[model samples]
Target: MTAVTLTADRRRGLQRRIRWIVTATIAYNVLEAVVAITAGSIASSGALIAFGLDSTIEVLSAAAVAWQFTRRDPERWEKPTLRVIAIAFFALAVYVIATSLLALIGRVEAEHSTLGIIVTAMSVVIMPFLSLAERRTGRELGSATAVADSKQTLICTCLSAAVLAGLLLNSLLGWWWADAVAGLVIAGFAVREGIEAWRGDACATSVGMILEGDDHGI
Candidate 1:
C-alpha cells in the first residue's frame, strides 16, 4: 500500500510538471507566431509565414494536451487529444506544401529576414529542452498524450531548424528557392508525424494498461 501510494504521488508530480511544460510551450508559440508573422509579412517571406503558422499548430497541440490533463479522467481524453494533434499536423503539412509549391513555381523571391532568423534560432534552442523533459516524464507516467505532445514539440524544433537554414541561405547565399525547399521538407516531416499521432503510436502503451480499453472508449 505504501509503495502504491508513493508511486501515485510521483505520477501526480510528473503530471504537474508536464502540464507546466505544455503551458510554457503554448505561451512561447503564441509570441513566436505574432513575431514571425509580423516579420514575414514585412519581409514578404513565405517561409517565415509558414513558420509562424507552424507555431499556431504547436499551440493547438499543446492546448489539447492541457485540456486532456484537466479532465477528471485524463486517460479517457487521450483519443480525442490525439485526434486534435493529428489534425493540427495535417493542417500544417497542407499549408506548408501549398506555400512551397507556389513559391517554387512562381519563382518568388524571399528577402532577407533577420527577425525570422532570430526567432527560429531561438525556437530551435528552446523546443528541444521542452520535448526532452516532457518525453521523459510522459513515458514514466504512462501518459500517451504527454508523449505525443512532446513529439509535436520536437517536430516544431525540426521545422525551426529548416526555416532557420532557409533564412540563412537566402540571406547569405542569395538562394531564394532554399526557403521553398525547406518548406517542402517540413511538410514531409509533418505528414509523417501526423500519421503517427493519428495512429496513437507516438509512444508504447505497455505501461499501466492504460490503453487496454482504448478502442472501446468511455
Candidate 2:
C-alpha cells in the first residue's frame, strides 16, 4: 500500500481527531456499561452482564489509544498502546468464557431485560459510525494504535448485535441457551482479535506506517 504523505498540520489534526473519537467512545461505553450491568443483574441475563463488561473493556482500549495520542510523539507509544488494547481483548475473552461456562453448567435461565435490549440496540446503531470514522482517520494518519482501537470499537458493535439477538430469543422463544451462546461467540472473536493485536498485525492497516520525517520502510 502506498503511504499517504501527511503534512505536519494534518498529522496533528488527525491526532486530535483520534483523541476526540476515543473520548466519545469512552463516554458512550460508560453509560452502556452502567445500564446494561444494572439491567442484566435484575434480569439474571449473563449475556447482558457480559455485554456490559465488554463495554468496560472497550472503554479501557479506547483510553489506551487516547493516552497514546496525548504524548508529544504518539508514534513512540504505538506498540505498547496496541499491546494494552490486546490485553483488554484477552481479558474480555476470559471473562465471557467463564461466564458462558458457568451459565451453561448451572443451567441459568435468563430473564428478559427490556433495558438491556434497548441499550444494545443503541450500541448497534452508534458504534459502527464511530469505528468507521476512526478507521478512516487512522488509515490516513498511519496510526496503528488508532486503527486497533477502531477495531475494538467495531467489536463492540458485533457484540451488541449478538447480545441483542440472545435477549430477543430468550424473550420471544424461551431460548435461554441463546445468552450463553452469544457469550461464547463473543469470546471467540475477542481471542482472535487479541492474537492479531498482540502480533502487531492490527497495524497493517493501509497507512503504510507513520513517519515524522521522510523515512518510510515496512
Candidate 3:
C-alpha cells in the first residue's frame, strides 16, 4: 500500500482491474440468484430465498462500483458511490433478519434441495477470490467505493458459507433451523459492514491520496 503509488498509468490499470473484477462478480451473482431463488421456492426454504435476494443486491452494489469506475473522474464520485453500496448492505441486513426471524417463528422445515446446496457451495469457493482482488486494487487506487463493494462481496461469501452449512445440516440431519440461525448471524455482519461503509467513505489520509499509506501490505 505504501510502496505502490497510483500514478496516472497505474490508476488506469487498477480501474480496469476493478471493472473486470466487478463484471465477473455481477455475472456469477446473476446466475446464483436464479438458481438459489428457484431452489428455495421449490424447497420452501426462506434462507435460500433471502440468499437469492442478497445476490440481487450484490449485483446492484457491484453495478454501482462498476458505474463509478467508468466516470471520467472516478475519485470525484467516491462518496456518493460508497453511500449506494452502504445502503445496499443495510437493505440486505434488514431483509435477511426479517426472513430469518419468520423462519424461526414458523419452524419452517424445508425439503432437501440438492440444487441449493450445490449453488451455495459454489459461491463459497468462488466469491472470496473476487472480493480479495477488488479490495487490493481498491486500496492501491485509494478508491473507497471499490473497497466498499469488495466488502459486500466478502459478506456474500460469508452468507454462502452459512447457507451451505445450514443446508448440509438439514440434509444430513433434521436440523431445519440451522440455515435460519446462520442467516441471523450473517445479517449482523452485514449491518456492521454497512456502518463501516457509511462512515468510511472518506478514509483517513486515503482519500485523494492514492497509494501513499503505511506498509500494512493489505
Error of 2 at 146 (Å): 0.9
Instruction: Estimate the overall C-alpha local distance difference test score of candidate 3.
Output: 0.88
**Tens-digit lDDT track of model 1 for 63-132:** 9998888777777777789889889889988998999899999988878888989999999999999999
Q: What lDDT does model 1 reach?
A: 0.83
Rank candidates, lDDT, best first: 3, 2, 1
Name the top TM-score candidate: 3
Best of the two (1, 3) by TM-score: 3
TM-score of each: 0.90, 0.92, 0.93
Span of 10 residues, lowest total lDDT, candidate 3: 209-218
Error of 3 at 107 (Å): 0.3
Which lDDT tens digits does candidate 2 get at residues 1-218? 55447767777788898999999999999999999999999988878888898899999999999999899988888789889999998998898889889988898888878899899999999999999989877877888778888988887898899889888988999887786777788789889998988877886653345534324311
lDDT of each residue in 1-218, candidate 3, tens digit only:
34445567667788898999999999999999999999999998888898999999999999999999899999888888888989999999999889988989999888899999999999999999999998877877788888889899999999999999999999899898998899989999999889988887534346767665433333
For candidate 2, report its TM-score: 0.92
lDDT of 2: 0.85
Model 3 spans with C-alpha error above 4 angstroms: 1-5, 201-205, 212-218
Off by over 4 Å in 1: 1-6, 207-218
